[model samples]
Target: MGGINLNGLFIKPPSSLLAEAYDALDPNGNITIKWDIISWTPDGYVAVVTMFNFQQYRHISAPGWTLSWTWAKKEVIWTMMGGQATDQGDCSRYKTSPPHCCKKTPSIVDLLPGTPYNQQIANCCKGGVINSWAQEPNNYGSSFQLSVGAAGTTNKTVKPPKNFTLLAPGPGYTCGPAVVGHPSKFISQDGRRVTQAMMTWNVTCTYSQFLAQKTPTCCVSLSSFYNETIVPCPTCTCGCQNNDTHPGSCVNPRSPYLASVVNGPGKNSLTPLVQCTKHMCPIRVHWHVKLNYKEYWRVKVTITNFNYRMNYSQWNLVVQHPNFDNLTQIFSFNYKPLTPYTSINDTAMLWGVKFYNDFLNQAGPMGNVQSELLFRKDKSTFTFEKGWAFPRRVYFNGDNCVMPPPEAYPHLPNAGSRLKFSIFIFFMTSLTLFFLFE
Candidate 1:
């Protein structure tokens, strides 16, 4: 867009003609009223405009003082009202006073970039008498039309969206929800909820051609904050002991990790069995991973059925190795499960199940479970230079570890158990059928 009049368009109304009301008209209905742009700084621009009023029969100042050229399209419509004639009965024709209050006012607006702009003036009054006044011969009224100015272009920066937040457990929380695959949290008071979030864009563009106008735009930013809530501290009240929801023998009756007892261990009469008959069954300690967007997993394991011999001599923990199939013994008196279960090391040992062995066995005098020969893959097979008795904890392969494929029926109960009895009856019936057929 080019600049308007170099010397600036200035208008000095003739003193002889008093400021009076005039109605402007044009074929296009209401004409747009605007002052030509006089001048402007490199940074800012100014525009002048006036509107004709019917009641006073003269022009008046329009509400929006700073006329914006972009808004001109919607503001140009005008109207005119004519007054009654002396004859009283509807005077359809011209009368002594101009009945058309806005009749003489021109409604069209035209902007010129350079040549001095001109305006035509005409008077409209109550009685219908139209008085035409002098204007530059080629033009219309007593209005001073000035050229329109161009608005300066600005380079705006698009702002990004606010960070996404997981609302529960409140903000600034670093701990994540348990269970890697589960949804982390529900919506909280502050509106933070789901961890996953995304951003969408909107743009305004003209459908048609060259020289067409387009809307300015910006970019959006997206982010998220993850918070974790510890599964409501598992209720210790009911005395549920197993993390896996096992049946009988409440192992680790106080731990939140143990789901529940699936079953109990052997009942031996020899040992003073302080059988926690209904317990949080010991989990074959395995790693439970919590994953965020990042790759690294926070691994944790909870060992149930930690038999701390009342004699304070033996400390035994049945743990499910990280790889899943292996069942291993962690400690036994001469060996204590990773650091004698001090308040501090208890948490560390649980989470370090999957880390390097040297560090894991560093539990000092507490690292037992070093007996039993490896029937299959043995930890000792790997170099354990840092002075460890057993290469890796070992267990009875035939008894401790036998993972049936997913489709296989789980272990059957002992003989005379419900399943065994059912099987016995079935075989007997088959034999009887064979005899009958014979």
Candidate 2:
């Protein structure tokens, strides 16, 4: 009777049914559950649940689960079955064993319900939730579990290295005479005045991430005599040789002739003295005398590695000037000039130079490299003696070199005056000695 009833009912034992259900519900039995905090906000956090060995239990739906954060004292319940569900008949009702499933492959479920609980939890947290998908979280979950098994949490934090600093061309850095120009008002129109100058410097960053990022930038404000008016040249005449076309011979040609013959080129024949006051009247003659002439300038720039720990792979230096057209030569052993020399624009003249490989190879911590630029005008007899202008914009790896108060004019000796002074001193000394001996 029992066998006949069992065959008619087609019933499986209660123990066997319970065992199957238990194994299906146990994550370790047929599936593995991995829980991770994918992202979070100040109020709440988002968790991810992954299931492995999902194919083994293709008939079973993903179990309902609960995620809890101990710090915020919050809990989120996810009741959706198999993450999605269809109104299919029960598998136990069929005699063909386990029934077909909605999701038959391994799956991942983002546990963010977008509910008030998630929002409230996020608000309760101090800082915004950090996404731990790429990195581990600083704070660990007190306890985490899926309906099937408990999951582990990765609790780790990352700190960035120290920031990089520019040491060589520190604050108030200046480049000496990168551009040469006359310091007088007479040659102002000739563009011999140092209108602008540019300087290059060194920069560094501690993080390696800077390599691929945009280069750092710094602003250097230039304070110069940009607004000063050009002083007019003093009035004078060319001694006996009347340069003006106003046809009129000197009343006393012998006096003017004697002045020119005695003055020569070293002395200013046009200068008025009390002895020649009568004959030194203003004449309508313009002497094409190039006064306050500046012939050449030596520009020196130094780049130093500021960071003691980091080494530079390569670097670019750019300098701009308004009067760079006077550049005659470069004196540098470490740097190489870039192509397309002296790029000119309406604003200024740009010079790009690169230092790498051999230059950087030997440059260790606190290493320095020096470069010199020689600027000259057409005339070799004159130079920007009073003081040449510096560059207006100087950049090192796109960082500007700052300028302090303008320095005093460089000491430039006048060759003609120096020779004349030496002669006068020798003559005076000989005369004094002769008188003393007599």
Candidate 3:
């Protein structure tokens, strides 16, 4: 009979025992769970399970459990411990061992009779589990508890979605609704709540909009003291003399002494006729380049009236360059009308400047006009040692100036020429000796 009884107990499946345990749980009773703050720090704290019970059942499997707390009336803290078997202890190190045999704290057997179980929860919060809890102890004082069972049992009270208010105008001039990627946040006046939203500035300029030809206006502050009030939009143009009467208009007709030289005939071949006429080639342009900064250069161009007999009434000069990544301010002296134009052509940048003067007083016989141009280039593509090969074209009154050729080096005789000269000398000597002998 004793042998039969032992055999019967051994033959009973483990599943039946598990079923019995599940049925013993009271469906109407709450699964009571208790938490205790074991250790605390300024950043966070270490918490443990002091006691937990489900009817009289000591072993219970509660997976997808969560602990939550209200923080600072702004943030809701949640700590999740994924699916775990309480009979074997939630500790990963002793997961295969029975709860009573688990050395780690928070063992199921340790908390079976409402006894406190000490163990550190892993990945509880942002700055480590313990540090995260200690970060705001004052906030944790309000509502800090643990829920055992499925994830649904945890507090999931949804708060109102945050809204956004424009603090001030962004780098862009206009503002609109928030965007997805760009997030911004601001605190309330009482500092109790924080408003967060994905904000984006309005489109300031687009590819098609910039390509369109229109008057460009810049936002300028009216008063230096306060950055408010959009100043009147002024039309921008490239030219000298920006007055109310001649706004955005360059002075035309550069010079008055723009006439060709003429030769007068002598009167009756006896009295010589003196004639003073303007020459077509009155101005001579001299280009001077000097390294200013890293890859920047100061190009000083001097226009001199080399002709001592004629004066230039109007003149126009155009200078070009290879690259103009950043063109500095242009400085011109003795020239009234000047305009700088920059355009992108293919892969290179084309920069042109027209220097003109309507009055002849600025340029007279033996007079000179000077202007300085500053520009930057790619260091790898441009260097002072390689020499400035730019100003691909320079036009003086529609005529391109001919660039002077580089200086030539002295010629030297090679080995082949020396051998040929030696052979000729040998033949000449042999002929002279034969004549002498004869």
Candidate 4:
């Protein structure tokens, strides 16, 4: 280079910004400030203060000293345009005396699962143009700053960091609507296979994703089958015929079957209407619930509506969880439903309820009851909010047996009795048809 004279100078150092207290974010992606200041004047610049890293330094630049800056580490003069150049005794090269504390960046920390955190960085420069630095943690955490300039400052923030927690399906969960039969029914078709069913789950971003990925199909392994047989038409007259009725001893309407279930949440009631047919009885019920994953870890489900209907019609329900064992329960109030009927699940920390009514053979009064349950794990416990009922869906499964035709109506010996039957025949016929089609 030809002879060059310097009028002013600036310096730039490599620096980066990083989360001061990050749980697991790497340091490379952060931004940093790199800068230096200088002056060139005949007085050789008497330094007042020195700022290392965040610290400040003496006054920079003078009337005669023109200043410019670029990314290059060394000073690059744009032109010899300034007045007279004077020796400034290298103002950029100042040293601190006495016991000096080494320059240090902000402190940081590693984040933990489900844990909340707070972090901040302060500006340390004494004077000069300093830009505010940006901070971004792995979780898009919030940022704050501390300053010594103001006496009292107030801040308003919304949605502060929340605590972390893990949740699971309540105790004793199982899969319903297995390939073969109801809960008690075994997979006789296959080997005496003892499947230690454990729940597993995969999340889909959209409803389409759930369908495309076939999650419902893949999750079948978590289900189990059971046996339930519907008794063929066993007729019983409830005696109430349409107009001009004639009541008899044989035609009596029995009380409806009551179903009560107690689980993690609470108690729920269901009234099942009995439909006695010449060959069998059938009922339909549906239930759906959305779980709140933010609430608790485990949940429980218990069904108990099989008082009298159990003897005539065997029914069962299947309970399932994403990452847990499948439980199957028989709807026989006389005894415990079965081992497979109850469950608590944690597999994918899921939320939702699926109802498969009389999965094997549908024979019974039709209706259902759902209740809240409580779950516990370690020191934390969870329960459904008080008195919330799981919504129900009522429809017949395709496999359930239909009621008998009305042609099999009981024949009477006297015309009066026959005429009475005829009077009620139209109404009775309608009732019979409803069951048959159902």
Candidate 5:
């Protein structure tokens, strides 16, 4: 699914774009939308629509998913539950009882929590958020039921909706044309009987990072106690500052309007009004080589959120390091190994514990999460020489962070020669002293 721009062959895509194009762990990852009509109405039919996230790592965060499609016929939504249309549309045509929505192209958003029980159904009222398959498989899907009117009651007469679009809070997913598939099977809650949908149509959507953003979201920095130097994020790794419009300028931390702007409308949106910095990244990951033990080594990782406008919930980090296979213990974070290359387990998925460090706050004193990783050393491969202790690649919430070059990493000091010479001189001095005393 990860392909170059057909029109612009000269352009080279970023490694993050290519590295995430396919998930070896889940080859058929996608968010599938299914419209399953259960019963035929006098005018139309009742459909129970389901949106399932089969993607292993990608999830729909706050201000969740907004699903839209163009109705094939003059179909108007009569009643809806579990979700509501953003617009009621023009219902003036009906004098007595207006349909829930009367638009030819209706946009629907999931209802928030605490919805009325009568208006709720299975897997509804999550404020539009959907978890990824691997992180929380049980919450990977959401469902809503709706009543349709002014449409054919039979499957042969009814045509499937077209031009499905998914705004998982933002643009990046492209959905294919709805294709009628095998009838979906349903069962009673008590497990007494089984039922099947009258008709079923599915829409599978894939993601492309190129369509998501022009700039990177996060970056990485490094430090080690052995060396005084602390490597910073590469210049303009996310984006560079400019003297032009608001795009380049950052919000002042003490600005008077800060309160209003951040808590204003669309508070849950992904917009980042971050602080001023050379890297201009919304998030920064700092890895410090903390302590070394005879049989083990420890590393401290800190994730700081510079985005003052948004808060990250259920955030996760993906890292690639050869030592992850030898990971012995991790503090304040949960770890899961990923084997994308069959047997090689150099990759790891780490996230904060539930209700603890799971929420990465906005830019402030409390806007960071820290964890210590301890790994058992393999004498053959464990060495402080060069940059062997650092991670090969790091990702923050699925965004690849720019790391300092190999040459810039903290290098081990070459003090072995000085120690050897000093030992030789000491031995010579001891021999002379012994001869004089004799």
Candidate 6:
């Protein structure tokens, strides 16, 4: 028999395809968790765990990352530096100086800044906030040291942790099982000495926008000086403005209780409480074709926040357009070129300048920041017609925004129609002259 039969139903081995998270602009983006056993203790071992954010634009923000995993063989944390477990689960078994954590599954968070000297390690603090590899390569990783009591002391006896999970303050990342890899090597800061670890393992995690949120956090609008019509963000691009069913979904700009609502405890919740608008999006990106010049063209970009309670700090925007390669100057924002595709140099990462526009404030009059870009025109491929000046794609804080339909974009005035009218006028004038002369 090819399969087993139960109650007239044939059963066979199970198999199915797995769904994966992918981004066209950032196809190779991921976070790697590395665990290296630096020393062997009497009972167990001491290991250093580090996290590296390899994504091009995505970063872990304040109230930062949380890393968790299930130990393979009854591991208990005896001591920790640079980070700590969220719980001291059932340390009651040890009466005198109990283990730092006594749990099979543990969640760890990075120690905040200004930690005591004894508790600090290299790349340890900053509240677990990590920038993307492209934006801040120097600050792209976080590290912590931990001493385990029950884990095996020898490399052969030790096993890797399972079910690793990463929440960079929130879900969207899916981690794979930790597997042993080549030994890790460490070098002294002075670059004079080096040391090698006895064992090492790694866990890689990928993010999925679909798993993160159903609705987009931002939207893009378009406008041009040549056309009077402005294409607005798509209606309900983020969510519908439902009042009766979900009273707390959004707040009116003029609501008297706005202050109390925004300052309430629920303000810190994961879901954003945005200002009521047609788009109902927390953030809006407006791109305007401001001016046209002989050799260079100008475009103005504006980012506005509608969230009542939250402020976006260390935020960044990514834009893709053909003219980015010829970009001359950006007015206020600091920019860095991102060459994810390698062959295409059209992507750019822009962020607010520190101490001025770095912090995007809550929904109000002062909630927006803007910058203007000047780009040298490439005569071979440059054209104002058919919305050629508009960006091909836009992303805010690494999350893609919904773009308005191409047909709705403002079009150039019909030059062909004017030419037709001029020809008809000339034909009428010639016919009148001939008839008069005859």
RMSD of each: 36.2, 35.3, 35.2, 31.7, 7.7, 10.5
Candidate 5 per-residue lDDT over residues 36-110, each given as its tens digit: 898999999999898877666678898899999999989999999999999998999899989999998999999
Task: Assess candidate 2 and give its TM-score to the true structure.
Answer: 0.26
The TM-score obtained by model 3 is 0.25
Please provide, for model 1 over 1-438, each residue's C-alpha lDDT reduced to its tens digit, 9 standing for 90 to 100: 221211121122222211221111101111122222223424322222222111111111111011111121111111111111112223244344522112221222222223222322121121111111111111212122222122331212212112111111111111111111211122333454422211111111111111211211001111111112122211231244453675433334354533322122343221212224232111122222222222121223322222322111112222222222222333211122222222222111111222222122211123222222111223533211221111122111001211212222122234457677788899999999999999
Off by more than 4 A, model 4: 1-315, 320-374, 377-438
Predictions in order: lDDT: 0.22, 0.29, 0.29, 0.21, 0.83, 0.87
lDDT of 5: 0.83
* Per-model TM values vs. the true structure: 0.15, 0.26, 0.25, 0.15, 0.85, 0.89
> Which parts of model 5 have CA positions greater than 4 angstroms off?
1-27, 254-269, 414-438
**What's the lDDT for residue 243 in model 4?**
26
Angstrom error at residue 217, model 1: 68
In model 5, what are the clashing residue pairs, if there are any? Answer: none
Evaluate model 4: give its TM-score.
0.15
lDDT ranking, best first: 6, 5, 3, 2, 1, 4
Better of 1 and 3 by TM-score: 3
Q: What is the clash count for each candidate, in the order shown?
A: 69, 23, 15, 53, 0, 0
- For residues 102-180, could you state the per-residue lDDT of candidate 6 as single tens digits? 9899999999999998999888888989988777756778889999988888988888889999988888899988878
In angstroms, the error of model 4 at 61 is 98
lDDT of 4 by residue, 1-438 (tens): 121111111112223322331111122221111111112223111111111121011011101011111111122111111011122223233353311111111111111222322221222111121111111001111111111111111112111111111010011111111021111111222445432111111111101112222111100000001112222222331111222452221111352322321111222212222332221122322222323334233223323222223221122222222312221221221111112112434211111132333223212233343333322223232222221222111111101112223232222235676578777988899999999999
Question: Of 3 and 6, which scores higher on TM-score?
Answer: 6
Error of 4 at 155 (Å): 87
Task: Give stretches of model 2 more than 4 Å off.
Answer: 1-297, 333-366, 379-386, 407-438
